[model samples]
Target: MNLYQQAEYWLSAHKIDQLPEDEGIEVAFAGRSNAGKSSAINVITAQRSLARTSKTPGRTQQIIFFKLDESRRLVDLPGYGFAKVPLAVKQHWQKTLERYLQTRRSLRGLILMMDVRHPLTEFDQEMLNWCKLSNMPVHILLTKADKLSRGKGSAALEQVRSELSGEMSVQLFSALKRVGVDEARKRLNEWFQITG
Candidate 1:
């Protein structure tokens, strides 16, 4: 299926306390600030503005939810590891993210976007830790693949694989170039089918 064409805006929850009832499959998108999480969502949904893109860091503070044909939900979580953001806000996101990662059974998987230039930051490691503890399947997308040459992308991918000790799948992606979009979509679509 063409995932982009099937997505629709469903809901946005600022706090975990306000999240809707656990309904269908939820695949969360997370990464450090400026990691292209929002842009990736926009590309996957084929909606230019469905997920807000920002040059500034720490703008997305909510766990936004978008429905995919009523069978699965794509979540855009706030960017973590914004050193300039207030400590309170960081703490809040951390608590919420950790809790959601640890407890949400409906969360079928996680799409962890990372800038190819800086594949795995300390915060990325922490997020991986949470995924490990939860035993959640994760897919790491090295965003901005177009920024690097083909050889560079391959080397970066290898670097990340060697550095991260986990079971998550990895792919090099470029939202601008539409690279790896199909692979990411296929994985998410499979979760939708399983949940449906």
Candidate 2:
């Protein structure tokens, strides 16, 4: 079976203390609320409900883990920059996210999602900066690309690329239309060190 097909249940870490031992490769998905991060994960994994998708933003409040066999895992982090959430909760998540990114030994890469039409909000820039400091690889997914015309989508991709530096990869994706699904899967497989 393919790596994504082999993915199975892994523990959810509500707190840093609940995280699994730092022994395997993990690639995390992060984005602002309503950026379609969960939808992108579902599309990439070819699993409809692997990560819960909701119309409500900021519904994912915990760090959920999915294991592709024993040594490769995918992480779904809490969405940031949602205004409706309480300040204390948001602060807690921010602290936890910072700690995870800075100290997690097995984190090999990150998949940062952004809405195609609204790429690079303040939160997205903050994540890019953090990844830069850690020298961690990031793949930016401009989600909801189907909402735009082909020319517009291509233009958005180019615009975002021109603004970015370093080794980060960026692509236009539409989970609803299955756009860029294969490309996202291939990059994730490479990051997870999974062989076909």
Candidate 3:
């Protein structure tokens, strides 16, 4: 908790060159628009507004970094899919995302957030495939678990697990219910400790 609580806004990179120096390890959080990405980050970090939640989707238009210390950081990537933005803006973000993911040596892992009701969207699959190709570690967070009954939530988890069998770690989560916060934090800690 101490490490996450120490997270403070570092910088926002609209272009690849605007990013911090590629040195310390960082874990990126990514999800489709409206997938509760901000809520999950705030909950994991124990900060109410660390990632900036919004009723309107696609408010995070750039890669925002939250520094946990000198050698650690949490990156909030721009949400993709259904952002209601102009085509040129979306194109720029797509290009930026591709370049970062492929070239960021300091990026240790990715925490992929997906809404429980909508587990694997087209965009999510593309991310998974890209990670697989690059041999990047990924952890999936099925956010908004509190919106479903216990049985339903478990079922959704199982289905996703079965589909992606033997690939990556996954768990149910809910920012509002405080579900799986510890588990998520543990994963983050493990990744941070790793040299990547």
Predicted model with the maximum TM-score: 2
Clashes of each: 0, 0, 0
The all-Cα superposition gives candidate 1 an RMSD in Å to the true structure of: 2.1
Task: List candidate 1 segments past 4 Å from native.
Answer: 163-167, 194-196
List residue ranges in candidate 3 displaced over 4 A. 165-167, 194-196
lDDT per residue (tens digit) for residues 1-196 in model 3: 4799889999999999999999989999998988888888898888999899998999788899999999999999989896578999999999999999999999999999999998899999999888888889889999999999999999999988876633488999999999999889888989898322
Per-residue lDDT, model 2, residue 24, is: 81
lDDT tens per residue, model 2, 1-196: 5788666667788789999999889999999998998888787888888888899999789999999878889899999999999899999999999899999999999999999999999999989998888799999999999999999999999988987777699999999999998888888878877667
Candidate 2 regions exceeding 4 Å error are: none
For candidate 1, which ten residues in a row score worst on lDDT? 187-196
Sliding window of 10 residues with minimal summed lDDT for model 2: 1-10
Better of 2 and 3 by TM-score: 2
Q: After superposition, how far is residue 189 of candidate 1 from its true place, in Å?
A: 2.1
Assess every candidate by TM-score.
Answer: 0.92, 0.97, 0.96
**Cα miss at 167, model 1 (Å)?**
4.2
Q: Give the TM-score (vs. native) of candidate 1.
A: 0.92
Q: Tell me the lDDT of model 1 at 102.
A: 72
Q: Which candidate leads the pack in lDDT? A: 3
